[model samples]
Target: MRVTRPMLAVAGAAVAAAALAGCGSGGDAAAKVPPTATGSLESLAAEVKCKPNIQTDADTIRQAICTSSAGKFVLATFSTDRGQREWINEAKDYGGFYLVGRKWVAVGDDGVVTALRGTLGGDVEIGTDHHAHTGHTG
Candidate 1:
């Protein structure tokens, strides 16, 4: 079959749309703890010096007001990656740094996050953005 210009254009548009659709939260936004984040709350708290103060939001999310080598800020973690990926995509705008492990996301603006990211091997990665958050991930 001879592919006409219009046929090529339609195929190209369909491919482009499919590619864009694949690049999202994957499914409906349902919150849950990712496997990696199950025990990460405690670890992150210890690392960020929020040990005695870590606050859990429904056991699926953890947050704390902590101070560390990087500075003082709120550290948050999500059990599932539902919205975490999207958050990481736009984190720099809100001073977001993510350490994704399997299914969990640990977010902060501490050197520890950067350090832990190295240990992730290759989970999920986001470039540090410091323009909005004032503190860079590194």
Candidate 2:
């Protein structure tokens, strides 16, 4: 059969739909728990051999600096449902994946995201834009 542009478009759309469907869940019940309980920044920092300099900037979230064997990264905890929703919206807008749990982890590089997978209990996604360097995500 001769492949046509229209045929390719249809096939691509189908694949994308299937992928989005799968994104509904990360496939691990544990991954659904709070990121802090399982893969919180303090936990991850210890795992990666980093020390976390933590701070609470608002009632909405807690941010931290994790300087580890891997590299410096930020982590955050949301105080309310609105904060979490805002985070998801912001992430989608900037082309990132929310490593879902009781909380989320947003990293900037594939390597950092990938390395955190085991701790996070699955693959985490990175953003196309530059991640905040100072502390946890906003």
lDDT accuracy of residue 88 in candidate 2: 64
What do the candidate models score in CA lDDT, each in turn?
0.55, 0.59
Candidate 1 CA-lDDT value: 0.55
lDDT tens readout by residue for model 1, 15-60: 9888777666542321222334334656755644554356656655
List candidate 2 segments past 4 Å from native: 1-41, 91-98, 126-138
Report the Cα lDDT for candidate 2. Answer: 0.59
The positional error of residue 136 in candidate 1, measured at the CA in angstroms, is 22
Model 2, 4-63: lDDT tens digits are: 988999999999988877776554543553343344556655765767788656667777
Q: TM-score for all predictions?
A: 0.41, 0.51
